[model samples]
Target: MAQPFSVDAVVWDMDGTLVDSEPLHERVFYATCRRHGVDLSDLDAGVFVGVHQYDVWNAVAHRFPPTVSREAWLADLDAEYVADQGSLTAMPDAQRIVSTLHAAGMKQACATNSAGVVVAANLMTLDILPFLQATVTLDDVKEGKPAPEPYARACTLLGVAPERAVAIEDSITGLMAARAAGLHTIGFASNHHIAAKPEFHVLADRVIHRLDEVLSLVTMPAAAR
Candidate 1:
């Protein structure tokens, strides 16, 4: 079947879509929470996968009985993630798809809820930073995923309309933002949370297993090329 419209660009979610940093993030969040006397063991850290880093911290902070301020926890978490940059790993086909899309002349941007520090570190780790036209994070907008602002900011930076772009994400929150921006959406089931959450899949037009499959699903418009 012909695509409804040629995909002129792609906006991707960072953590699970392009890079498998969920485990690393989870570990760090859990560790940070532990230090603050907040036990996240009972709560699924998976729920925070695509949420804004500050929001996550605030929520955890509210639940914890820690005497330390949330700002202190944020500082400590940032320090740890910077020191443990070794934890980031590219998802399957992340390189192949990104490189191919760049070569095809598709504009690309990453819309992530992670902080700039983590986003920069992961992009550098995956070696896809140079391939992207823009990167939008919590710091870039007043609202994060589940809010259309981040994706809207990304589309604006990429100089593309949301309807002409495809958004690939791993979490419902990310998909919600993409959909709210009127972008076509694909769910990358690389995160374990994808299985536990059926409603997330319902938000996507299609769910893909490997990043390379994105190449099969989209083609940059001739004008962009």
Candidate 2:
């Protein structure tokens, strides 16, 4: 049984955790790279999981000809992603977990490395915005994941101390950010990008294969401690 710990708030990672958009993102990223004449293998996509799109753009720019403007490449990718929002869906148990937490009177927020534009589009598409009290994006922080700034800023925005919050993540980078912020971390392994990583085993406080299992943590008596 998981021990209970009290938290005034809960923070979430948007892409793979709340929304089943990882596969879509991989597809879009690869397509975008191909359009820019940059080739990325499946292994490359897996390795880049959890990084910000701009970071990926920078890397892609380095690999491709300098003639490819980073801003243009990023803009094209963003446009494609936004257009595909209609096909986005909430992860299994995501809606239920968020709804349950809201009903339980716990503060909820989304802290993601994605840009605000992307975050807002997906949140609206998945219809999970009503349950989110705060939304922090890369634009809101000086650095992206693995830096802890985003997660720290999110805790500040929620008026909750890091130790009094729980974070759900699906990537090693996201886990590192949440852990660095001193928040309890739960790793969701539903995404192939993270499922294959050995680091996840020791990085997260707990790991769950389905989004619904997340509710178990919130309800666990240990979580209320």
Candidate 3:
């Protein structure tokens, strides 16, 4: 028999899950890499999808050798993305679902591998910051996604047990972290950037094609599930 789950809280992964920023991320990263003298013509950008920005930098720096300091490269990328903030938009039904969950008395929080500054910007832009009762950013956890610390911290802050919460993630990396933290995971596949992959579906406890689909899962009674 499948174990019953009672969800009282929803933990969200910000980047590709709630915000449509992966294209912006890829553009900035590629430009930054090229400026730093790294040749990526032979490499597919998809490999970096759903990956932590810092981890991507570290891996690329190690593999190709960096002509610029990692810190400098990161600063440039962050600045560029921030400057292009007008391009950032919430995922389809993102704000509606978040507000609906909040109205339904769900304890909601965001756990992301993005830096604190980036998190603030994205949340503010999406206008969903006020609905999130708690937020765990990359700066809040020493070990980010794939390590479980981010989601663990978010659950702790929300005062919810891991098994009693549902984590919505768009990347395989984030799914691993949510599973490690013992939260029921939903793969948000609003776009083809990352969660559309088979590995994501395999890892997620549930796969949702639209943000509104989350409404049913979180609202369903434990007995029904």
Candidate 4:
């Protein structure tokens, strides 16, 4: 393949985009809520899927009050996630895309709404930590997804402008952040929401169901070769 346009960097969102961790997280979150005797029976856990952790608490505070404080419930969930980290798996073709891009010498960074601890845990579990040149967690920015700060910070840390980079995301929150940061966004519609909620994925410059498809989009036009 010959090259015309080149992608200088890739900003990734880890949970649902790169790994099948969101389902596990959803189960753990509800289980922790029940352990504390918080009733989430009425609320569909899916509603909280793409929201930031801090915002999730705020959104569910009154309706799903846990026996412990908000932070404690989150701590419990995080610990459960760590304990079950082994159950997590990389999304189909996620490792392939990352490895291929890494081999191609493109810069990469992970910008996740999750805190550094969870981010590091999953990255290590997937053995993808080495391929990523940088990681920007919620701890690294004033604001996380749905806000441009996290993605922008990732671009800065990667030494690339947002326009020169692309972001692979699986949800509205992260896609909004990437678009706002001035990067081309690819929406991974591995779940129903991304495929069904066309209005929600409006920020995505392109939408693909599989992670491997990203390679073709990021690379140059075929005619250029």
Candidate 5:
């Protein structure tokens, strides 16, 4: 059995952890690349999973130069995501987990590397914004995932110390950010598109296959954590 731990606040990663948006992101990315006549046949699409769009674009541009400017490429991707907001559904039990924690009087927030525009579209489209007390996006931080600023910003916004908070994430970058920020980390590995790997298990305090498992982690009381 998993040991109980005190959890006063829950910070979530917006992409794969809360919303099933990676597939959409990947699709749009490839479509945009193709439009720019950039051939990514040899590139691993999985590399684009958890990082910021600009970082992804920068890496792509460095390897296979795109015809469009960074701003234009980003705008195109963002517009595509926003227009396809209907496909931005929540991960299984993600809504229940958020609502359950909220009902239990726990503070909650979303910390993401995504831009505010995309984050707003995803959360608002999925009706998750109301349940989140705060959201820290790349726009709100000088540095994003793998830098700890996003999660740190979120903890600050929630007025909760990082040690007392739990962060759920689905990507290596997100996990690194949460752990580096001093929050207990849970790796959500149920998404087959980004299945849990060795590094994920190593980084997370615990790994859960479903979002519903977060309920127990938050509700249970521990003698010591």
Candidate 6:
């Protein structure tokens, strides 16, 4: 059974949650690392999941020669990813869920660990800019996910309290951020993060494979009124 729907706002994670761009992102990461002569294994790729691109670059740079410039490497990686955004896709039922929520008068916002440019590109790609009431990026916060600042900032922007917001996330880091912000969370397991096990117990207050399941949680029950 699903939990009852009672939240006033929905806070979304843009990357893997709203768009099917994680795999493409991984490809770009591998390509960029190779171009810089860095060998990244699958596990190394996994470690970067849900982290901001600049942070990932800085971390990766630590494994390279001391003289290597992290800023230059990050710029190159950003260039590659920006050029590759054309291949991105909206996740299953993303548009449907978002549209339904918007029509229902529920507040909606995007809280992502991604850069502002990346978030803008994705919103443009998915044609969902008009539906989103607020957008928060890593640049807007002193700290990113797992720190709670992103989600907290998002709720503030949306004019909603943390307890009144529901967060939809696809990675453990994202789940932790939302949880830390005191919001109810739903975990989507379609991507690499939760593919191995139904780790709902670890990341989310609730878990569902399909986006439509969110409707049950966000919609008011007849008995409640």
| Candidate 1 lDDT by residue in tens digits, 163-222 | 988899999889999999999998888876564588777898878888877877886779
- Model 4 residue 172 lDDT score: 86
lDDT (Cα, tens digit) per residue for candidate 5, span 1-225: 887558778899989888889878888888877877877778778887788877887787774554468898888888888888888788887787788777668889999889888988888856777788999988898888899999899999998899999999999889999999999999998565565467888998988888888887765324322
Query: Which residue pairs show backbone clashes in model 6?
Result: none
The candidate with the higher TM-score, 1 or 6, is 1
Put down candidate 2 lDDT per residue, 71-121, tens digits, no spaces: 788788788889888888888777888888887778889999988778888
lDDT pick, better of 1 and 6 = 1
Candidate 2, which segments miss by more than 4 Å at Cα?
Answer: 219-225
**Which residue segments of model 6 deviate by more than 4 Å?**
42-44, 192-200, 220-225
- Best candidate (score: TM-score): 1
- List, in order, the clash count of every candidate structure: 0, 6, 0, 1, 0, 0
* Residue 198 lDDT in candidate 1: 80
* Candidate 3 global TM-score: 0.91
Give lDDT for model 6: 0.81
Collision pairs in model 4: 2-225
Structural similarity to truth (TM-score) of each candidate: 0.93, 0.92, 0.91, 0.91, 0.92, 0.91
lDDT of 6 by residue, 111-187 (tens): 99987777777887778778889999887999998789999999999988999889998888888899999999988
For model 5 the local lDDT of residue 8 reads 75
Residue lDDT tens for model 4, 19-128: 88888888888888788777787777777766778888887677654455778867887898888888889888888789888887788899999877788778876788
Off by over 4 Å in 1: 1-5
Worst 10 residues of 6 by lDDT: 192-201
Model 6 TM-score (2 dp): 0.91
